[model samples]
Each structure stands twice: as C-alpha cells, then as structure tokens.
Target: MLNRVLAVALAAGLVAGLAIAVLQHFTTTPLILAGEAFEKPAGHASLDPAAGLRFSGATIILAHSHGEGAHDEAGWSPTDGLERTAFTSLATVVTAIGFALILMAGLVLSGDPIDGRRALAWAAAAFIATGLAPALGLAPELPGSAAAPLLARQIWWMGTAVATAAALWLLIRTPGLWAKAAGLLLLLAPHVIGAPRPEVYASGAPAELAGAFAATSLVVNAALWASVAVAVGFFWQRFKPHAS
Candidate 1:
C-alpha cells in the first residue's frame, strides 16, 4: 500500500509540476510589458478667427501606474527564441522535482500514513489558506502589474482556489480515468474564465505584448499551488496507516 501510494503521489506531482512550469514559461512576457505607465502626456490645439492664430502645446505628466499599464505593449518583447523557452522550462522542471523530493521527506516524518481523507483535509486547508485568501487580496501584489484591477485579481484568485480544490479532491478520492479527466478540467478552468485585458493605448503596442501581465499572474499562482500540492502529498504519505 505504501509503495502504491508513493508511486501515485510521485506521478501526480510530476504532472502537476510539469504543467506549472510549462504554463509559467509560456505566460511569462518580457520585462518591458510588465511595467506601468510613468506618465500621461496631453496637448490642446485651437484656431482664432480674429487673429487667424493657431496654438498647440503638450505637457509632460507622470503617474504611479506600473507594470502592464506603463507603455504601449508594443514595446515588450518575447523570449529570444525556442532555446530560451526550453531553458526556462528546464528550470521549472528542476524546481518541481526538488520540491517533490522535499515533500516526500516531510511526509515520511509526519507520523501518519497517506490516505484519501487525510489528503483531502490537507489539500482543503492549503486551498483556503494559500489559494482563497490570496484571491481576496490578502496576499501581496505580484511584481509586474502593481495597478492591476482589484476585481480582476479577486476573480483570478477565486478561480484558482476552485481549480485547486477540485484537482486535489479528484486525485485523493478517485484515482481513475474519470477522476483524471476531472482533474485536467480543473487545471484548465482558469484559462476559460480568462484574465483581465490590458488597457488599450491610442498609440498602439507591440504584438508580443499580448496578455503579458495576466500570464505573469498565472505563472506565479501556479508555482504557489504546485508547491503546496507536493508538500501536502508528502505529509499525507507519512501519516497514512498510522499505528494506534
């Protein structure tokens, strides 16, 4: 039983980790797109009939907006090429594997054996503490978009919590084909709900700038949940089949 549990945990962890990494890599936009507008310039032009005079002037302005709101998104750049993408993916994979190993060690020491009920409880706690709370803006703002809409942030967080809970529940309760399908659906739920769109610039922005800030949030959130999942799985494994 222990062996079976461990095998399943490892396999699930790997898939979760890989998904997180790939999502992060693809979603990460160039640093330029992550910035906020520092200023907004304005000008006015008028013509006078009496003197037949025309006047036009522009003034410099500044703002606190940062990240996704900074400049026309056209300024942002994508990763140099496929090679850089591969490197990022590899980095995420390594981090995921390391996290899994650590979780396995912790589970072995928790004095309880892994089981469905325990896994569900742990996952639930994690979802509430880490996922739900952050969705409510209890968590710090992400680096790229300091000015991201509060409502949008809340939506993202709520979606994330639901997805995580569903995935964990399915994995712990029913480890079968249908359960796997449900888990995958949970994983992809956020994409369907979509993220906040960047405010359009009158001047136009770069093409690669599409969904830059949203992508960053997705990556960061995924990493956080992936870490929690591995940790919960490890600890659950340790406490399962505890000797009374």
Candidate 2:
C-alpha cells in the first residue's frame, strides 16, 4: 500500500507540475513580468520568479515584498530565462508531490475505490479546499500588491483549507443530515471570519493587470489540480495489480 501510494503520487506530481509550469510559462509568467514592470522603481533591480505556485499557503501567486527593493536585496534568486524556468518547475513539482501525498493519504484513510472518474472528483474537491476557498477571501496577487503580514495570511489560509476539506468530507462521505448541516457551517465559517487584509489597498500594478493575473492564476491552478487527478487515476489503475 505504501509503495503504491508513493508511486501514484510521484507520477501524478510530475505530470501536473510539468503541465502547470508549461501553462504558467506562457500565461501567468508573462502577466507577472508585466506586473513587475510597474513594481520596479527608477533604478531598483527586478524581482525573481519565486512568487508563483509555492507549496506554502496553497496560493498560486504569493505576495512579494516591494519595500526598499527587498526582492533584490533579500538573497540570490534565479535569473530571468532558463534558470528561472528551471527553478519554477522544480518548485512546482515539489509542491505538487506534497499535495499528491496528502491526497493519497486521504484515499488510504477513506479506503475508497480509485479510478480516473473518481479521482477527478477528489481533485476538484482538493482544488476548492486548497485553492478556490481561500482565494475567495485572498485572491492571487502580483508582487507589488498590498497584503497583510505573511504569517497572518498563512495562518488564515491554512485554517480555510482545513475547514473546507473537513466540510467536503462530511458533505460527501457522511450520510446523516446532521453531518450535512455541520458541513455547511464549516464551509461558511472561514469566509464569515474573513481573511486578513491590508489596511489600505495598494499595488504597483494596474487594477486591470492585477485582475487579469488573479484570474489567470486561478485557471492555471485549476489545470494543475485536474492534471494531478488524471495522472493519479491513470497510475492507480495501472498499478493496482501490483499494489499488494
């Protein structure tokens, strides 16, 4: 069981990560670069591509520190072309694998039968819990966008994800009406509490451009999760005979 789970996760993560990286390279990457144009001051150095799809916070785009040219002064980052692409792909793959492991563990715990169709449902739930739910309160932002403190945002994001996941499990897996009612409350609790926010809304990027980036990021992340499901489903079926 352990070996089968790891194998499926590895394969799914690779496929999803590569797919997302390619999509982002053409889509979100350009938007991020354009947003950075607004972020750079008269003489400040450019920020790195490290702001996208990190495993941390379940966010497609992360908030970048814009004050004092902190992006440049913080530490070494991959340069603009192939190096950045390589780093992004690596980070994405690692993040995908982490997510995959979580999904696989849930499957194990649930003891549910696995297939492409079923896995697709699971992936959609995962996307909602980890991506869309939190995004409702905290949309993806470009580097120059104003944001609350990172730690606070992280805490809220995690809470939202956990709440959403538990709610989903209750709604889908449990049968009682009480379970459904509890699920509904859990689903709404995070949004009711609200996400952390900056006192003032500000950004170096234009409103139009930032909106575009947020929408594009959500699309890319959706594709990533879907791809993971397809890959996991494929691998799980393929390896079933050998799983024991």
Candidate 3:
C-alpha cells in the first residue's frame, strides 16, 4: 500500500513537472528570448552600436529610451538563463509532489464515494484560488518587456481553462482510456497552439507579459486536477468494502 501510494505520488509529480516545464519552455522562454533579441537591436540604436554588443552576454537588459520609459506599474522582469528556468522547474516538481501527497492523504481519510459535482466544485474553487487569484494581481503587473500579443494571450487563457476543466471533469467522472487521452491532450494543448508570441518590443521589452502569466495559471490548474484525481482514487479504494 505504501509502495502504491509512493508510485502514484511520484507519477503525479512527474506529470505535473513535465507539464509545467513544457508550458514554460514554449511560452515564457520565448518571451524572454524575444526580449533579449529586441534589447540587442533597440539598445544598439539608442546607445553606441558597439556598446550594444557588450550587452549581449547579459541575460536581462533594462533599457529605457527618453520616451520608452518603463513598462506598466508592474515590476515584473524577464527570466534570465538556465538558472531561472531550472529553479522554476524544480519548484513545479516540488509543488506537485506536495499536492499529490496531501490530496492522497485527504482522500484516504474521507473514505467516501466520489461525487463528481462536488469534486468539480472543489476543483473550481481551488482553480480560482490557486490559478486565477494570483493572476489578477500578477498578470497586469508582469513587466511590459515580456508582454505577449493580446489576442494570443486571450486564446491561451481561454483554451487553458476549457482544457483543464474538461480534463478534470473526465478524469473524475469517467474511467476509461478516453479520459486519459483527454487529460493528455489538455496537458499538451498549450504547446500545440504555440504559446503567445511577442507583438512588439521597445527598449528590449515586450508590450505585455500575459502569456507567461496564463502559462503559469495553466500549470497551477493542472496540479490541482491531478490532486483531485489522486484524491478520488484514494477515496474509492479506502471506502470499498471487503467481502464478508
């Protein structure tokens, strides 16, 4: 039983980590790269062309022309190199493991029949608290340097919500290969769609950073859904009565 629980926890954690890494790689990394690329050319023109070459090695360069100024009031900054990427990835994995263990323990304790609607309601509340709440404050504040195209960001968020909801609904309500496939698709959708791209760059910054925010939200929601699944599975197992 302990082995099984450990296996489930590890699997859930791995999946969650992979999903986050892929999303970040496709979404946030590109924005950072774009910011870097833009900074090179913009800085070159604003400063000595030769001096701009010196800035190439710098992972993040903050340049503000007389009028360009800083991005929105938000103090968000672009992620640097592999250090930030690795840190983010590690954080995702750790969070996933913690969530899986907690949910598994909760489900084992509850020992009640799975209630799809109740599960969904709980999932939705978790989604709002974990996914949307931080976004409300963090989204707008993301440094303008990482700003992505508005339409693309909107599509990413809408798709993420729909995919995540569908994945969770199916995973808990149905038990079949189809549900698994749906969940996989939900996990891969952001990468398939190609995360939002930068629309414009000024002073080495994108106009908006919503794509990164949306991607982060998606990752959080994915972990929540995974927790729901582990919880539901544990509940069903614990509550099943043995033959007399």
Candidate No. with top lDDT: 2
What lDDT does candidate 3 reach at residue 122? Answer: 52
User: Candidate 2 at 148: error in angstroms?
Assistant: 0.7
* Candidate 1 global CA lDDT score: 0.50
Cα lDDT of model 3 by residue, 1-244, tens digit: 5665666666666666667666767765566555444454433434344544244454334442222333443254334567667877887777766666655554445563444444445545446434663344235323334457667677676766566556665666568998888877765565566556555545434445445545655664655565555554554455455779
The residue pairs in collision within model 2 are: none
lDDT of 2 by residue, 184-227 (tens): 99999999999999987767577899999999999888888888
- lDDT of all predictions, in order shown? 0.50, 0.82, 0.55
User: What TM-scores do the predictions have?
Assistant: 0.35, 0.85, 0.42
Better candidate by lDDT, 2 or 3: 2
In terms of lDDT, the poorest run of 10 residues in model 2 is: 54-63
lDDT of 1 by residue, 81-177 (tens): 5855677666665655554444444345555454444444554445453444344333333233324477886677776766766676576666799
Candidate that beats the other on TM-score, 2 or 3, i.e. the better one: 2
Candidate 2, superposed: residue stretches over 4 Å from native = 40-72, 242-244
Give the lDDT of residue 99 in candidate 1: 48
Candidate rank order under TM-score? 2, 3, 1
| lDDT for residue 117 in candidate 2, whole number 0-100 | 77
Worst 10 residues of 1 by lDDT: 36-45
Question: Which segments of model 1 are wrong by more than 4 Å?
Answer: 1-13, 25-79, 115-117, 130-244
